[model samples]
Target: MLTELIEIIKDTFLPTIVVTGDTALKTDLALDSFEIINLIGILEDKYKIEINVIDIVSLITLEDICNYIANKKMP
Candidate 1:
């Protein structure tokens, strides 16, 4: 899932420079507030999970996003 998320990020945002784990989303990926929303929409649609704005604010890293989706699984 992490790998898939990384791929999605890469495909969604074509970074001019190399992106690594340490790279920040707002700086390296240039993902601003609006892009974040767009990303959430894509993720929600792709994963079939509902994402809240608070969830988006709480996410800082790729792992965070993956973990959020993982935890939202309907049991």
Candidate 2:
């Protein structure tokens, strides 16, 4: 799932950079405010989960996003 998310991010957001779990969504990718919002939307849609606006701030890395999705997927 993490791998798939990386592809989606690369294809949709950054094609020039290689994204890994440790990649910082802010510093590494340098995603601005709008891009971050768009990314959150894409992630929610792709993973079928709802992310609160407040939680968005906590998701600073690829690993954070992966963990959020993983936890949301738990039954």
Candidate 3:
């Protein structure tokens, strides 16, 4: 899941950059407000889960996104 999430982030936002689990979505990648909004949309569609707007602030790293999606996903 981590690898796949990395790929999605790469394809959607950072096409030429390599992102790791510890990479900060905002600090390291410099994702702005609009980009974060777009990321939420892409993540919802790709993962088939609904992400609350309030959770956006908690998603600070790639690992955070992976964990959040993992919890939201049905078994």
Give TM-scores for every candidate, taking all chains together and pairing residue i with residue i. Answer: 0.82, 0.94, 0.91
lDDT of 3 by residue, 15-69 (tens): 8987899999899999999999998898899888999999999999999999999
lDDT of each: 0.79, 0.90, 0.90
Q: State which candidate, 1 or 2, has the greater lDDT.
A: 2
Model 2, span 1-75: residue lDDT tens: 889989988999888888899998889999998999998999888878999999999999999999988998999
What is the Cα-based TM-score of model 2?
0.94
What TM-score would candidate 3 get against the native?
A: 0.91
Q: Which ten residues in a row have the lowest lDDT in candidate 1?
A: 15-24
In the predicted model 1, the residue pairs found to clash are none
Cα shift from native, residue 7, model 1 (Å)? 0.8
- Model 3: ten consecutive residues of lowest lDDT: 5-14
